[model samples]
Target: MIRHLGLCLLLLAAFWVTPTAKAATVCTATSTPMIFPQAGPTQVDSNAVVTVTCNTFGLSLLATARVRMCLNLDGGSVAPAQIVPRRMQNSFGDPLNFQLYSNPAHTVIWGGSAAPGVPAAVQIDLEYGVPVLGGAGTATTTIYGRVPAQSGLAAGTFTNSFAAANAVLTYRYSEALLATPPWPTSCLAGGNGGASTGFPFTASAPVASRCTISTATDLDFGNVPGAIATNRDQTSAVTFTCTGRTAWNVGLDNGIHAAGTTRRMRLGTSANYVRYELYRDAGHSQRWGTTAGTDTASGTGSGGAQTVTVQGRVPAGQMVPAGTYADTVTVTITY
Candidate 1:
């Protein structure tokens, strides 16, 4: 009985001594890939810089990891897509094409030593230390690119993806942002400065003068003889005063007269003495002289003020007519 108890105890001790293996499972965490600035259409001006950011989170890996970016043109999944340099000159003065590489790559290089066809894609490898409990970790990187010339290809929508493969990793991509070229220097200069000189203006005095008739004296006929009587000649003067300066070219016309008729009757015979004449006195060059009658006497003054005279004469006749006749004159001036 003691021996049986001993064997049972020994069997129980052996069972306790033998270690039970516990199954171990590989640890892994997945995160969604993300791109910054969203993903859509993109445009870049000449000498512009474009930035692309990729972020990875919730990765459970304690070892090194890598992130890569690739571009597909016209749905072409090839390693590299063709990029045609537009409005830009290449190293050899030829058009440039697109290229790709494994190293962190970027697109759109500006006036840089690197040729236009350089790779535009990039890959970033992150070697994170052992992951802490709860599978919490994150990785981020940025890629820069540039535009080459004043103008480039018509911008369009480009689809890109950020993928974290080794071990389940979650990643996300943000919208794409476009960069514009610098402002034009010539446009700024035109606003503040110009080509011509703007200064020193002058004005001159007036050139011509004007005048109007202020007053006109009434006509006075001297005494007249009765029929079968004697007749006498008489003279009278109508004076005008000038108010303004000298007129350039002065002229005169018969402005005033008996209503409806342009004719005037004289004291002598109807045909001989019907018209009148005007003259200037030698002593007073500005003063005018009298003539046969008062209807036709007219004159002009150019420089200064002057006097005007009118004269009339009646001839003797067998039967002297008895009546009164009169007319007026007008004057005009021009520059």
Candidate 2:
């Protein structure tokens, strides 16, 4: 028993005296999420930063590591092949077109090997000498995003992840103590190798429709003679400018004199009225009323000034009151 005890003690001392291999290196990655702003132009941009950190325990000699990163995107309504023309979906499942790039210049498409035509992965080459125990070094890369011009999309928040969906980021690194390594350009957007985790980011765009209406030019008729010989006609215009392809309607409400849809001009203080009508056509066949898509002037915007001609006429031989004749019509545009 004593001999066995002495042998065990000697083995324990030898194990303590023996040197083991230096601790292996480890790496971690994180990203700053990006948000793209709303715009009418075909292209818009936003940016985010991806950071990689590597740590090495105290070692007498220089230690180096090779790191790589890639994306594992959640499937979207648009196919992976459509990554060049990517689309983000809203809560209602509506899609807004957009894309991600590797540089601020937006020349290169950021993608993964998993996605054809897209880059397979990104690499970070690191090197450091150690006397300090477990020191960390960091490398950062920028990601650019763009939202292309669209016919139309409702205002809301759009994202890559919804429901149980996720946009995963995979990080792979070699064991510490490797020689200086070469950087790879081919594998940037696609996941290459290493451990992975959820990379949470929010992509959003706010849409606000804009339009301007002008009634600066009102229908004005010169002083009427005592006896009307023929119909007195006058022309005025209502001009508007709105965003491209935005559907809008112009409604001219019944004048101050209210007789249902029949338009009229009234005396300043008296109940007496003169019958008049507003028409959209020169022939006065299409009466311009207040009903949308029915009696109203409806059009799809071209992002420019659009004029709607207002033709008015006073029938001859009415023999009505002759102070100052005028009518105030309310023009309302619903977009």
Candidate 3:
């Protein structure tokens, strides 16, 4: 019995003296980029996911670990400025403003402690050495992105890159036995194995060439009840809205019934016709014609309502029956 007791004591002593591997919670993370839908003159929105993976690496007698992560995503270059956040350079740099948020409503902006903005927080529980080989766990959080409504932005792909050292990933962890209460309160707390590293991600969207003619006022010369009328001058307006910095030409097509470049307002289906013309200028020197470059009003869009005046004139010395004379002229906008 005494020999057996000595052997047991030796075995227990050897086990206690043996060297042990360090216990730690090693963590890594990846981010999915936020991609907005096609953005135009209106605000666009999108969302992405950040996946955090925590692994109980090495030999740890710890049964479990609780991790706290803080994501500071604002300030510096990764900001949501209305004009500088997203830029698509064509001939010149077109600036479009955007922002990042933590909530789906987009009311809460996503920023880090450095931003002094509310940083995204993620907490997870991981089991250490429970699976025999090792144990790992993953947690996911969402990031919302929004590009506020703006105009005059050049057409191209607009992107905001959070790459290189622009973005940072950080975490804090504490190990314990099963059903443990004490854990790290904040990841931003100083010291105690807190680690920080950078991760890369992007927020991108595209703007295409687009234009619209919102309204067109009629050119009314008023009633002319006489044998022949004096020279009548009238004007109307055409409103065009297009993407900023876009070049466009507004052309006027001849009426439904016309001879050569002459535009005339026919009286019903009779042989009577009133000679009239549409000009790009008030002096009636530049005739508004179907020609795209020539005889057309050319201008660059400011991404807002642009008014084009159409000067119309009816020459004197025309005899017509007492009735309403009208002509429909088509307005064509070429960009």
Off by over 4 Å in 1: 1-199, 227-231, 241-263, 266-305, 328-335
Model 2 over residues 1-335: C-alpha lDDT tens digits?
Answer: 45544444444444444333254555565667677777554567888777767665644445454555555444333334356576776665656777777767887776545555555444445544443355566777777878887654544566664111244555544423334444333223321234555545555665555567855488976678786667888888999876655688888888888698777788887877777788888888888888998988888766667888888887787777678767899888888
lDDT of 3 at 311: 96
By TM-score, how accurate is candidate 3? 0.80
List candidate 3 stretches off by more than 4 Å: 1-21, 41-43, 60-62, 76-93, 114-133, 149-154, 176-181, 190-192, 225-230
Residue 16, model 3: Cα distance from true site in angstroms: 1.4
Candidate 3 C-alpha lDDT tens digits along 1-335: 45544444444444455334334666777788878887887888888888777776554344555667766564434343322243433335566677777778977666555433345433444433323355777877787888887776666677667764556677777654433434576675632356776657877888776779998999888988886558999999999887877789999999897888789898888888888999999899999987778889998877778999999999998988888788898988998
TM-score of each: 0.25, 0.57, 0.80
Candidate 2 — which residues are off by over 4 angstroms?
1-24, 56-62, 71-82, 114-116, 129-132, 162-166, 176-193, 212-275, 278-335
Q: How many clashing residue pairs are found in candidate 3? A: 4
lDDT of 3 at 184: 70
For each of the candidates, the C-alpha root-mean-square deviation to the true structure, in angstroms, is 31.7, 8.4, 5.4
Q: Against the unseen true structure, what C-alpha lDDT does each candidate score?
A: 0.28, 0.64, 0.71
